[model samples]
Structures are given as structure tokens and as C-alpha cells.
Target: MSGQNAVREFTAQMSVREGRWRLYVALLNTTEQWPEHRFGHSVPTFMDRTDALSVLGFAPVPGAEWEWTEDSETPDDPASPVVLIAAIRVCSWSGVSV
Candidate 1:
């Protein structure tokens, strides 16, 4: 699949949670098809509504303004760290904390 297509698919799979805050998490494949290439690396990234808007590079839809924050914790092993991105809804989607 093409890189753009892959990204689109990843975005489509994002799920939104509702309660105190509404957020979405999506795993992104940052690497190209060829592992030899410098861009051929995959990592999971989380995006809230605002982050998603920034990524999509356009003005957000009406009533879709929300803020998100990223939380990362070091693993007990110390060798690995757990990273998380969460979207925290602020007044009318002012900004994201990530």
C-alpha cells in the first residue's frame, strides 16, 4: 500500500472515548515499505481531535475543537518506556496538551 493510503487507513481506525474527556488513539506506521530506507520505521502515535486536525493539516470541523495530552511512563524494566497520547477536551477545543 502507498504511504498516504496507509496513513489514511490508520486515521480511519481511530476510536473516540467519551466521559470527562473525549480522545482518540491511532497507531501510525512511520516507515516506508522498504526497511532499508531511512523512513522505514513504525511507531504508535496517539492523536486527539486537535492533533488529528494538525496532522490532517486543515481547519477543524465546527464543534470539533478539543485538547489532548500525551502521557508517557517509564517501564519497570527501565529499558522500555510506555508512551500514551490522550485527548483532553477543553473549552471548545482550545488546544491539545501533547
Candidate 2:
């Protein structure tokens, strides 16, 4: 399968404001291929590096164009260390079993 059609994982780092906007765009971009595309119908999740490593078993893969974010003040919510949002593609094709 071509890269566009192939299921893959992507990670983006952004502030809360930017992250929300990205989520919106991803939803729009993948709507036509809902459940088929990586971002299609996918609720992108925001996670910090630490949680991603420990809980999600994430490892850094190359080839992502990093964007610099300006640190800004946010409400006091320590539980929300969501700097990294991962967009992972999923494909399920059950072939006929003989």
C-alpha cells in the first residue's frame, strides 16, 4: 500500500491551544476515510513524553518536522501534561480462513 493509504503513527508536540486546533484539522482531513485513515474518526490523544514511554510504550521515531512552541501560562491543572499528541493509524482486514 502507498504511504497515504498505509496505516502509520505520527506524533506532534504543541501547546494546549495549538493541540486542539490540530485535532480539529485531523478530524476534517480524515473524515472521508473514517475508520480507514489514520486520523479518520480518531480522537487524537495528548500525552506527555513520560506517560507515553511508560504507559503507551512509545519510542521516538525519526522523520517528524518539529515545531517550536512558545511556553504560555495555563490554568492550574497538573494532571494535564499533554504536550505530545499521537496520531496512529489502524487497519483491520480479516482474510477468509480456510
CA lDDT, every model vs. true structure: 0.31, 0.33
Candidate 1 per-residue lDDT, tens place, 1-98, comes to 24423222222222222212222333234432211101112332433334544443333334543343443365465555434333322221222212
Query: CA shift at 35, candidate 1, in angstroms?
Result: 21
Q: How close is candidate 2 to the true structure, as a TM-score?
A: 0.25
Question: lDDT (0-100) at residue 87 of candidate 2?
Answer: 42
Model 2 Cα lDDT, one tens digit per residue, 1-98: 34445434434232334334332112233433221212323334434332332233333344433344433244466655445433432122221011
Candidate 1: list runs displaced more than 4 Å: 1-57, 75-98
Q: How far out, in Å, is residue 73 in model 1?
A: 4.0
Worst 10 residues of 2 by lDDT: 89-98
> Could you say which candidate leads in TM-score?
2
* Clashing residue pairs in candidate 2 (N, C-alpha, C atoms within 3 angstroms): none
The superposed Cα distance between candidate 1 and the true structure at residue 18, in angstroms, equals 30
Query: Candidate 1 clashing pairs?
Result: 31-41, 65-93, 66-93, 68-87, 68-88, 68-96, 68-97
TM-score of each: 0.21, 0.25
